[model samples]
Target: MAAVTMRLSEIGQQLRAFRLESGMRADEIAARLGVSRAALYRYEKGEVIKLDTVQRLAELLKVSPLTLLGIGVEYYSRPIGFFERIRQIEEETDQILQIADPVAYLVTSPDYDRVLFQAIAETQDAASGEQYASIMAARKSAYETRRPTMITMLPEQAVERFLLRGVCEAASPSPELRDAARRVAAAEISRIVEMIEAEPIGLQFSVVSEVDNTANCMLMRGRERMVLAINPFRADTSPAASTGVSLITSAPEAVNAHQRVIEALWKDSLKGKEAADRLRLLLAEYAIR
Candidate 1:
């Protein structure tokens, strides 16, 4: 019963999002569906919905039945408070295991917050990106405050690319800003380097040469939740300003599958001294560029 209720709520949220995305007002949608505005409101509020009504709603919203069903995962489209959502999940989760892209986020480096502020400050697009910047700042605060355990996978080649050229639109920051960002990025990786040399508890770091980046995912062990984030934006791209998508689910089967994938990737990843050596090689190359 509880699972059904949860699924219903997820579906409702997705329906509302799709409707909004379609730019169809509730009255318009309700009238087309041969329902009153109150009935339409009930549908979006996760009230019991019939299959036929769902199909009709799908047609009205120009979405598939599966999309309206919340069949496998709950989808979020450039969610307004995306970082806040993650922050909420993080507070509940005791540990996070992430399969990241080259420039993975949620870093625990001592100087990361400073770098973040500088990047936001130096960027001309900050005003246009205010909502993203604010949410990102809040997310950072939440993580720093909660200090949840995290295992992060960093791709050696990707880090090299990141150091040489910032991700997405961040590629063209002022030389001073770029250089500052580079030094911070290098230092952040170096701290990971030190961690590789000196293994730490509660936090684990790995660098892989072979890209196991089939999908970027976060497994929140505490919340029994897994986040499948298909971000079209790069690491430097603010998720809030980007058109990427994220799906979250507390379904045990999905979580288990994600955990298995993370474990396999972790096993294949380079760790400790070997990973440290890889970072050194990259840094040496970066020194010239």
Candidate 2:
């Protein structure tokens, strides 16, 4: 076969992700590939590697040669570029674990899907940005169609806030518009309530009475890749919102650290009927008022 032309930086990313998700230390993988630790670091830094060495790397990582030649985890500070990359990853992800705001980012039911899109459409119309409209539409469509295995950790207060105030970003908007946003928010919360009660397939839902927002993020776990995105802003309003400095790693060290944190938090959090009843009480209070 002819040698494939792949960018060192991109290939480096795949190697790192594969290494991390595989839960192997750099030294272990490097030793298996018959390279010094420093050489392995250089390879992961996008340094040139011989085609024969690429074959060794594929064997060590237990992946096809093409996998290493393809896309890898990336970090982005810019809004448009970061969101575009995230949209791509999200579309491809088979499982998602999120530390959500009032509304869950993914795993929303079909009835609530319309509400989420309406919130996005309203936010887009207010900004008058055609590009964002398309981006948000694509994101919503991807989630609706894929509906990847979903798990979320939601803050109790944030859910109450979202149910009441909604995510409309209109500046001094009309009452009817504001009402629409609230309805969207309400529906989004209702689905969570429903999920807890129904426990649909591929859905794992939970609510935590208190969650440290600083550590919250959306963690997408793919079969061969993993992305940990840190976005400070609540995503209920728009999928294209400017995420804070995000971390994308396929390295075992970092991904495992995050996994431990998620497990610890989930253990301390509320779920099943307990979480549902608490939310239901809030729902009733908000509705009756």
| Candidate 1 residue-wise lDDT, 1-289, digit = tens | 7656655766666676566545466899999989999988888777888999999988887667876786655455554434444555565667888866554466645465555545655553554356455655666677778778888877666787766654333535567766766777677666677876777667788886777345667777664345543333444554334366667666677778878878988999888788788888887787324
After TM-score superposition, the amount by which residue 7's alpha carbon in candidate 1 deviates from its true location, in angstroms, is: 7.1
Clashing pairs in 2: 17-250, 20-251, 20-252
What ranges in model 2 sit over 4 Å off? 1-80, 109-128, 169-172, 212-214, 238-243, 287-289
Name the candidate that leads on TM-score: 1
- lDDT at 100 for candidate 1? 67
lDDT by residue (tens digit), candidate 2, 176-241 = 756766776667777778888998888877887855463557778766567777656554445445
- Badly placed stretches (over 4 Å) of model 1 are 1-72, 76-81, 108-128, 167-171, 223-235, 239-244, 251-253, 287-289
**Any idea how many clashes model 1 has?**
0
